[model samples]
Target: MSKRTAILQTAAANTDAATEALDLALAMASMDQSVQLILASEAVNCISDNPSKRYAMLELLEAEPILVFTDEPLSNPHQLDIEIISSQQLAPQLNSYNEVLQFS
Candidate 1:
């Protein structure tokens, strides 16, 4: 009865795709599932401090726990309340989840 799921987003160039992925994750969370979103690579840029192009996705992330990979520097690191972790930490953490969705 494990409802653990991981949503991995790595495409920073497409905001639409990132928003769609966040919406899907929100839907799952609404169903009482434990969901975690991982923003890595260019995808970390999907979050911004200001209410700009990625505002919608940023809003959704506030509802859930998000992990941002620190391999690269983010455009606005102070914008979102994200857990910054390294690539080495990502694999072990991901393995703990029962399911994973990649939106890249």
Candidate 2:
């Protein structure tokens, strides 16, 4: 079995890096590779603010998305299943993945 992957999206959703991260996750998921996304810092904006575009992108994908936040309640118009975690929990969580792709 292929190693599970955790993609770290640290850039704001408007940037190319964020888009690339999502693309990579989608591609990997389509190939049957286990994939997950880690949204840290500004990357959480992808779903927390003006989420329509981001929600559309995620609608067809099968990867689990995780959000790492500190002192900010998360809200979204979309119903995507998201795993929320604290910033302090990020280190150990990321360490649990066998592979990590970062778009920071």
Worst 10 residues of 2 by lDDT: 51-60
lDDT of each: 0.71, 0.76
lDDT (tens digit, per residue) of candidate 1 on 1-104: 76788999887745777777777777776666778778877777666434234334444544455788877655664465567789889899889899989988
Off by over 4 Å in 1: 49-64, 72-79
Error of 2 at 66 (Å): 3.6
Error of 1 at 14 (Å): 3.4
Displacement of residue 59 (Cα, Å) in model 2 is: 5.8
